[model samples]
Target chain A: MTDSWLTSLITATPQEGFELAITLSRRGVKYTQPDPEVLHRLRPDYANSADSLTAASHVIAVNFQTVAAANNYWRT
Target chain B: MTDSWLTSLITATPQEGFELAITLSRRGVKYTQPDPEVLHRLRPDYANSADSLTAASHVIAVNFQTVAAANNYWRT
Candidate 1:
């Protein structure tokens, strides 16, 4: 696992594609189906590309305790 | 560059160390320092290890338009 999470995609048009990407991001609600412990929510205020939200890899978000608990639960 | 950013650190104790690490994370303000365009901010609500923050590698936060703009500015 390396304690990392990564996801990537190449855009045909960096600008338009980025807009679409973020738009889709906004369009999508943060949810963790099958894993209730994990609640995926985008960092608001980090809205605009110029304001916040830059070109970086996958975002890191976790409910570690829940994750650990869930992990334990599953283990049990 | 592979269009990616990466940073990593190994912890001695995953639990206590994780708390300390996140405490340090909370203590620090999101700043780009030299690169004003690259605004760094954490995804909130994602606070507790069980709440949101997980043992994932570094988080990704960016202001791409500013990044591109700043990039162009520096290039000019």
Candidate 2:
């Protein structure tokens, strides 16, 4: 995504990103994509699992959308 | 998925499936989950790339959701 494209989301708690999403939300106004290794481990336990995290919905959406894009790229 | 778990989708024309999806949509009423090889190739070209197909929204959704699930499982 472009730089300004990500400025749109409002996380319930900025900290929920790292706490619930395993993301580095506390660092800056800009979000670099999370490390691939971290992303690998932070996946939802099941479909819609991230729906329950109150403060990290944006992170959850980011996570799901990234994977969905990758999936769109390589179906397998 | 269970036997009944797959009875949910309605692919239009049914024949457009194999054409647009690169899938074997004609054989049965139940969806067996496309082959891993075929799945790998039929993925949308971009985020929501499959949105253009007129007869296969179901296939696109299935493809997107499958990759999303796989992404949720592996994260990386």
Best by lDDT: 2
RMSD of each: 17.3, 18.0
Q: Please provide, for model 1 over B1-76, each residue's C-alpha lDDT reduced to its tens digit, 9 standing for 90 to 100.
A: 1232112122233343344434323222222112333333244323334423332234211222222222232342
lDDT of 2 by residue, B1-76 (tens): 2222222112344443224223212111112122455334333422244432333434344443433343343333
DockQ of 1: 0.06
lDDT of each residue in A21-63, candidate 1, tens digit only: 3323332333323343332334333432322322222221222
Q: Is the docking of candidate 1 incorrect, acceptable, medium or high quality?
A: incorrect
Per-candidate clashes come to: 13, 1
TM-score of each candidate structure, all chains considered together: 0.21, 0.19
Which residue runs of candidate 2 sit more than 4 Å off their true CA positions? A1-52, B1-76
For candidate 1, give the lDDT of residue A38: 39
- What is residue A68's positional error in candidate 1, in angstroms? 1.9
